[model samples]
Target chain A: MTAPFKGYLRADGRKGIRNVVAVAYLVECAHHVARQIVQKSDDMDVHLIGFPGCYPNDYAFKVMSAVTTHPNVGGVLLISLGCESFNRERLKSAIEASGRPCEVLVIQNSGGTLSTIQKGREAVERLKAIAAETPVVDMDVSELVIGTICGGSDGTSGITANPAVGRAFDWFGAQGAACVFEETGELVGCETIMASRAITPELGAALEACVQKAEAYYTVMGYGSFAPGNAEGGLTTQEEKSMGAYSKSGAAPICGILQPGDIPPTGGLYLLDVVPDGEPRFGFPNISDNAEIVELIACGSHVTLFTTGRGSVVGSAISPVIKVCANPDTYRKLSEDMDIDAGKIMEGRATLDAVGQEIIDSVLATAAGQRTKSEAMGHQEFILTYKAFDPLGPACLPLKRA
Target chain B: MPEALILLHPTDNVLVCRETIAPGTVATIDGEAVTITQPIEVGHKVARVDLRPGDKILKYGAPIGSMTKDTPRGGHVHMHNMQSDYIPSHTRNASGGAA
Candidate 1:
């Protein structure tokens, strides 16, 4: 079988489904000006993402580096409030080292906020022109990294979209694509079952331990990752949600356990341990769905499959999000926002295999340059904040095992 | 007949309501007819058999939680009578949440 998509070939020889010029604000003080620059550029490919704090955090630097250097990013414009300590110079050098056109503008050094926005806008315009020069290359399914996340899930989600995505993940795995599923907080109850899928006994133990970390972390914060609306949508407990979420992995062997920004050395299904290593310092594992998706993109995911039951209308900035609706009822109310109707499985109008194939078809189409509903609607929502982690221990990456 | 309630997994002790079942609606379970004791919304769970307090609630063939109070078969099973066996869940999980 041959790969069906032609992707943007990057200078590093990696391929990307989207070529985006990231306009990132180093601090909250520069966010408005960066937003203005992206707005003035009037390009769908110019995306906004930023960290709001002024603190110098190793974790933040790592995440920002991974995100800016992501294969999907063709060029970057760094907007900084000169007083902040986010280290814009290092980031600018990183982008330049990778051969992408990069420019850094400090609100204080660029002649204040207004002139900076004007300068940033011109930078984006120049970046767009430079980004168009990326070579087109035929990328195999093996070269693609895809990720899945379920949000606003309800009772029907597990039985429908989640499992369908699992099936799709299975197909991708068989074809040698790297697949990622994340949010350890939501997988608390399924650790035992999830561990059993690991490629080696040691990796299985590592998988179980990460879920334990998430369970303990959320417990200290006074809430499980299970949300209130989950109850309203007929989800009664965390384990049940975990079971449903577990289906998104399909039946693939757990190839590796990765932390945020850790790339998979090869193809197969990998579980991203989003829960911070060590004790809970931050309030929650992931503040929002986009936060998780951003981590997946940083790990080199070209497209994301987002399964929603209660109807999440979110899309990411660097990668296109294919919203798969799991509830027939929710799909009816938000048809325009959804890309696939896995909910038909509940209605008995469609089978899981059909929807699974539909998801795969959607992925290939999106990879081949057709815009997703969210991308066409201009939903480049992105956010990055602070969190720390110890590097993945030997068992987590397990090169010998995979 | 309204779309019959479903048993998500063979070992599950809870029936997922595929459609809303009004109070007193007689539903079949394990070849036995059980009358619904309360109004249950779609996506909610119903006791597949007589449930006693301390009984582990099963769904998708896994233990989701445990009963906090005794309830007859076909009775609505939710947060009031059932609680998470794991950590305390967010109490206000409603329509509004971060995307």
Candidate 2:
């Protein structure tokens, strides 16, 4: 009930734990220049992220717009290759309208990569200066938006880290915080169980249908969206992995279902349906863990709880990722990358509730500016790819419709 | 069971090994000791009870897959014996998953 964290209040009224200056490239051609700008800035708070397509997509625009104005982002510097189909002006105007300091540098107009990088570095300095003066506001637990994703999962993920995250989610629910768990591809087998936990029957049906869509999509792609490390790590089936992945939801009632770029309107548990609506224009719903993290970030998650049994060490650009090791063996191998030792639950040395509290405490500490292991290790990875959507059905956006 | 073996749910038909179990390691399950038939790696599953082929494999109290071959108590349960009823799973080099 107490506001224990102080957040940078954006001009648009959203609060952010990290005021990052994002240098986004409009297409793959400008990626080098954008990366150079951020790398040369020597500022940990500045990051590079971009889409690779030259084709303009409404879905891309929507996600990019939402991400650029995300609460974690204070300012944006868009780098365009000048000839790509991506609408830089539209993206720039959206950021400006959000009252964030944003500008676009067309590489061709700037003469070349060197010129753009130099201009981009100066832009980062100005953005950082603007970000520094942003007002700090006290935020309550109720105002926090937390997300969970499981990557490189194995057998222990379900029994330990995933369930522990679920327990932390239960605490977040008790504190009235908005929490999100995602990857419909990973939630395939647990749809019925997941739907039963929905706040309403309509929402339950909507949740089932989303998983159905993901199953069909992945089936067409010739793979179950699982990785080889998963098997080596002792995961036998995709649905089995889904059951383990489902544990991160804890036992909270599902309040709503969302697509990327759609922020939760009220505090409760929600499901983020990352699969594209129409035909699978994108090869995979999520290319990797960071892709899914980006969608969660697009939904305005302040921090992400990442469970990895095969030892993935990725942090997001816009939000800090708290890595929870699910296997005691993997934990020993990559202790430096992990924030919480949920693996102890598997070893019987620690109870689930204890590790769950550790996760919640990590969230509070990260919000209070104590960098997570990933953040302190400077793992600012990001990726945004193209996809299409046919708008949400009647039941998906309950809060927005209500 | 060795402290390393955990039953996620009362209804689960498999036990998750918290650490690798060498052959001949005896685990006390439900107060009964069962000797490991084969080496089971950490994070792998072991049959909690006898199961026939086509029987549903339950973990986390949910059906993860189905047994492709009969499995005995204390036997290692993985892709060799069980497979997902949903979309077929793949490793890095193989593509012959059941569709």
Candidate 3:
């Protein structure tokens, strides 16, 4: 008795909610060329995404590969400056082997800026035609991977948007869909309670240790996880904020901990440990909300649940972000940018369960190709920064076969 | 209807201004009309009673930060006169800062 949702089927037997052609710039140098190609194409499915770093990084390589191979991407066009550190050949081969059409245009080799833009535009047009030929298939909710993140947080974020997302997460997990939540740095005080929900004893310890690592890293930076604006917004302590933010994970048993590029082995609840594996090489784990979203997409999320009290307006390159507004006033002011109004819980207009159901409905609708506010407004924010990670500990992925 | 500025706990000496309070505006709390001496931005807090320096700034029934200078009753409480107790945040340090 449920309505059927339609999805695009990729050649690798994966289902995609959105069939998008990803135009990627290998480094910051080629960003303009990539942008010009997307702009000239004027296609809704053509999205622009890339790394801005001139230096090569393992994390960047992994993220780029994961994004290009994401189910949502129907094709990929790599814009290289010819001298950048990103492995363009390997990336092209990976996308090609995945049965998606891929093209590489080195700016230096393709004459100069004007000539390269012409060639890139031609390549994109060709890819667009090929991307249109991908097959459409019926998809079920069970095959979906959803990620949750909170930004521009205020006191209401935990009380409203966070819990509402938790409700949706619970529903998704019950339906056998994988739900992921990250930012161990933000979950400092609630680690003990969170670890208790781990499905296995080893996963529980790994959960605790990840939070400890975030605490240590933040301390070295001479700051607590708490921000000044958070204090101004009625949050008293770092742990208190953590307690509020942690609610977005819902009450599901933790399945395993995944790093930035590590995909979930099976469908269930997963925790992403975004902090670097060794000493902090990058200045901060996530410089902004878009960076975390990029990591979630790299982990193969089809869509993202973004909760905010201060009102963040960002959509992803490969995945659609559903914005849940936490504050009633903010929702009224920025309703154009938000998808769901969670402030109803505080105003006594709606119950948490009702809001949760609303989020679940939104997810299903979005999976069936509903455009979120950010997506409608064309907020394709993307960012990838340098990070080091030791592989997930054995305890982190208990489901992995020996 | 305008939302009420709630005091999360009875032990808390300060209350959050859930909505913006303009300069010279009067707000009623517990049926008492308290006149605002300065503007208090939404999400910021106001002292329910006069407090000396070092008194814990409470919201949600917990110590959020500490008062740097004496704050009068119904006065705006923010960064210029408040400081975090857990870790002191630095701004524009000339030396030993990020290069």
Candidate 4:
């Protein structure tokens, strides 16, 4: 029998792998002050994360609130530029009502940048001391929500790291943990194969529709999902790349389709429809890997499994990311950034199942609070671009209990 | 080890190099020794037989691209000699100047 792991339980009834106090700046003007506070706090758990947009966006507000109240965040310190459009009072109230400590430091009212930094530092120190006392409870694998993403992909990505993640996804799903795989734009060619793996016909249709939305969005953006570097790395077409990327979803039947902020109703496989609904208002669905990581965190993923063939080093603000290297040569060059070597598959040394088990073990270890390579290296890469998403249609959430 | 190069699909006329092959390296296919004249990177491909221009470069049993110039037996195949037959890619103007 596996030993039960201890997890930090938040007031919102969610479990987190780490307890962190987030210092968030409301706009770009207050960003420097927030960074200073986090730096002065000298606490690894005290992290700086913020939105740079001065223009108010409802999606940004929702994501910020969700992150502030996330299970991983033990407390929050909001920094505002005083003239920004974000409603700091409501944000503070939401954090306070969640039973977590929160403080707002307005640069204009707090005597400018230096003074505000001093005050913000004091607030963070106090929050850290309080958060240090939060209790940890016993948790099981079934309660874990894991998200998977592939970046810096090459020809070997699908054959190795992706399929390995798929194997882990299957194991996690079987163990009752919710698993999410994203980048519908990357899943263009595998639509039929992906739909066939859905648990129900309705879910199958939803999966197809999400892919269609991604294809339409990218088409308007004037590019196939295929990238030039992808060709340089030996990937030929969009569909071929899709086949490789789709392998990360594992072989489990997709139980539901989720938009950017929609949380999964239960433990099962979910396809995150990252494309915005209707006409593409946002320039691109996801500007980069970090954007997708933010969306996964908003959907309640406690940890993320990132697969790469060309190599990527990124960790999110609210969750830890486990990097799986797919290319043997790239792994040699970036060994420190990677958590697992699925390249053994290419070397003819390890089978896909063996690497898959390794990924599952890594997930359990990460959930038990083991810091991933990216997390330990202080790689808190976060990005939130502008995108419009209509509420999920009824067909998208057929599995949810009404 | 199966071979220095393996055809991933039956219809493929090109074979992916399983390991690095230097210029003048001799490799056997179907029990025949074929001498290479150009170095090929691992994961890159080489024409299995003489190929004419406009012929599809098949790998993994699919058309990866089309040969821009005629390639000889055991010749290295890459961007310098092959081009994508799908949507033509360009650096300055990808979508015909549509921003």
Candidate 5:
């Protein structure tokens, strides 16, 4: 079956569902100015994203570089405070290297907030013009890189939405689209089972080690990824929530492991390890839901499927998030904010396969440019912070191309 | 009639409430009549069998946590009686709103 959609063609030969002009603030100091520019521009296609750190961080720089060059991004307008440790010149070069239009504004050099806002607005107009010139091309499902994440999970998550998304992932993986499921922090109890699904024994071993690392890291932090909201929603333990979140990966054979900026080399199932490597010095691995969404976008996911039992209304800057509500009650409360209601599976009014097909159909429709509930409501949430990681070992990416 | 409780897996000793079950509600469990001893909200778990303090709480046929106290059949299985073997779960009240 050929699933076809019209997409903005990038110079790197990747297809983008959205042609967005990103107005990025390199430091927290420039955030106000950059935000003003996006707000004044008043265009849904213009988005705001940034790193708030004034200190130098390799992880921040790498994620910034990955997001700016993401296929969904058409052009970029970078705002710098001029005194921050972030490498603006290198980031601009990386964006330009991908053949996308990029410009940087220094708030200090451009005469502070008001003047920079004016100039940034003008730059956004120019970038939008260049972005609009991107040719529209017919794209197929095989070229899509889709990511799945479960947030605000509960007992019903595993029973409904999460497994339904798993079925969707299975379908997408079977169709040869790159399917990524994430955060070893949430995979604590399922590591052994997940490893058994890996294509090679070496990759399987690497998968197990990644989860062990997450468990150790969280143990040091005095907290697991399990949150208060989870307990309130009937999830009693970290492992229970982990099992619920684990269903989002579906049943596909694990292909490889990916660090934040590592794009999948082939069309298959990949596990995105969001936990920082080495000692846990940087607090929680992901501060919030949006951070994980950003990591998924950094992995070059064209779209993300977010399954929620407690309900989360978040859409990323570069990609669309399809919210699949697991609880019928939450779906009733946030009906306007939800995309698919997998809660019906519990009522027996609909089957899991039916909801899974509905999710896939919603993805194809979203890929073809139908706005998700969050997107239509103008939810362009983005966040980035400090973290560190050593390069992935050879065993992690057995299928990686040089 | 809507199913009051569902066993996710054949081996699971905990049954999940398909809908809210109020106190004194009569529900049939495995051909045996049992009365709901406490309020069980939708998506919450109930003991499928008599559970002891050291017994593991099984859901989806996997051990999720351990029981901290004895719970009779159809009793609510939640944070009050079960605790994680990996890490302690926090609540808004338990962590002083830090959660």
Candidate 6:
């Protein structure tokens, strides 16, 4: 078992790896003001996040509520372009209910852009002050919620960094931590194998159905999640990439399925079904890596493990992302940006077990307040786009012992 | 020292290049010496045996894609010779932008 670390205790009794004051814009028109507030604050802990849609969306509202109340979040400052349709009042109420300091500034009522930005900055300072007053408490691995995602993937990702992350996930899950692995669209061909690892037969069927939804959604969109960077880095097909991405889930028996804003009921392995439930209306399930990270944060992931072969340099707004480089060449090129080099396994300098242990150590250290490379370089990238998802079915979340 | 190629699974018909291999670089495959015919970058695959069009290309002991063209042993097995059984992979040429 891992030793307990000093974690920020939230009002709801959840523990956070980081204490962040989020500046959220209800609409795109207010995004500039929110950005200015965060930029002027000169505090890395104050991050910029928002839904850029003018129309109301249940999915967006749910994700925003979950994120604002996330364990990692200490407080929230809302920026609203007064006439937009986003329910800023309801969002503020949700934050207040979570006992976090929350303030809303309307662009129109607050005298427009310059004034809103000024007020937003002041609100951020107050939130940050309130966040700093959060009590520090000893938190265990069982209290942590960790997420894993792969970006800029290549063929090397499967054999090295990805499987290494899987091993780490297995370890963390065994230790009673909620370990989530996502990108159902990427799990196209491995549905059978993935389902076989589910704890119950009913949950297994749900797993297969979710992957089918992802396949159907991607088919309608006329493109799988496979990208040019993936091919350029030697990944040939979406299924091949799926097989690679699937390895990040490890061999842990998946306890349940979770949608974007659904928190896992207990600590164990979880498969986050990121694809929308209905016929494909939105362009892609997740626009970019950060979108998935945001969803993971919304689901209460305290820290996220990011594996890459071609390499990506993105972190999240509230949670810190630990980049595990798969290919030795990519690691050498982007060493400064990576947290763990699982590529060392490919180079014969380290074994998968060694690299996996290194990843766990890094997670423990990160939870203990060590700054990740992305965090140090100030890469708190966040994005929340419009999407629709139905509530999970009964079988989606099998009862797991807490 | 790192080997030129690494076989991921016993049933896999493709061996992944451990490093950027140059033409004429010799590698042992299935206990037989085969010389690389083209420059294969790390993470890319090379044919373990002669492959014909429509043959399922196995990697990590499962079919990842199928061969669209014949490839000799030690020849590169990638986008040029293989195609996905499900979705067609998009590149910069098709999307007209970096992905």
lDDT of 6 at B84: 89
Chain A vs. native, model 3, TM-score: 0.98
State model 1's lDDT: 0.88
Model 2 chain A weakest lDDT span, ten residues long: A393-402
* Residue pairs clashing, model 5: none
lDDT of 6 by residue, A214-322 (tens): 9889988888999899998889999999999999998888999999988889999999999998877778999999999999988999999999999899988899999
Cα lDDT, all candidates: 0.88, 0.89, 0.83, 0.82, 0.92, 0.91
Query: Model 4 segments beyond 4 Å from truth?
Result: B2-17, B23-39, B45-99
lDDT of 6 by residue, B5-72 (tens): 99999999999988888898899888899989888888899999999999998888878999999999
| Reference-based lDDT, residue A159, model 5 | 95
Q: What is the TM-score of chain B in candidate 5?
A: 0.91
DockQ of 2: 0.71
Clashing pairs for model 4 are: none
> What is candidate 3's DockQ?
0.21
What tens digits encode model 3's per-residue C-alpha lDDT throughout A1-402?
A: 346688878888877899899999998999999999888888878999998888878888999999998999999999999998889999999899888999999999999888988998899888888888888888888889999998877777877789889988998898888999999888876778899999998899999999989988877766665555566565555665676689899998999999987888888899998888777767878888899999999998999999988888889888999999988888999999999999877676887899999999999999989898899888888998898887777899988777
* Candidate 5 CA-lDDT value: 0.92
Comparing candidate 2 with candidate 5, which one achieves the higher lDDT? Answer: 5
DockQ of each: 0.63, 0.71, 0.21, 0.23, 0.71, 0.77
In candidate 6, how many Å is residue A199 off? 0.9
**lDDT at position A13, candidate 3:** 81
Per-residue lDDT of A1-402 in model 4, one digit per residue for the tens?
A: 557799988777788888999999999989899898888887777888888888887778877887888788899999999999989999999899988999999999999989999999889888888888778999999888899998888767877899899999999999889999999988876777788888878878888888888888887887766666566665655665677788898888888888776778999899888888888786888788899998888788989999988888888787899999988888989999999998777777798999999999998999898999999988887787677777777777667999
Cα lDDT tens digits for candidate 2, A1-402: 445789989988899999899999989999999999988898888988898899889888888899999998999999999999988888888999988999889999998989888999888888899988999999778888999999999888988899999999999978988999999999999989999998779999999999999999999888997899999888999999999899899998899998899989888899998888878767988888898998899999999999999899999898999999999989999999999988887767899999998998889989989999999888988888888888788787676645
Residue-by-residue lDDT tens digits, candidate 5, A1-402: 755999999998878999999999999999999999999999998999999999999999999999999989999999999999999999999999999999999999999899999999999999999999999999989888999999889879999999999999999999889999997888888889899999999999999999999999989888889878888788899888988888889998999999998899999899999999989878999989999999999999988999998989888888999999999999999999899999989888899999999999999999999999999999999989899999998998888767
Overlapping backbone residue pairs in candidate 4 total 0
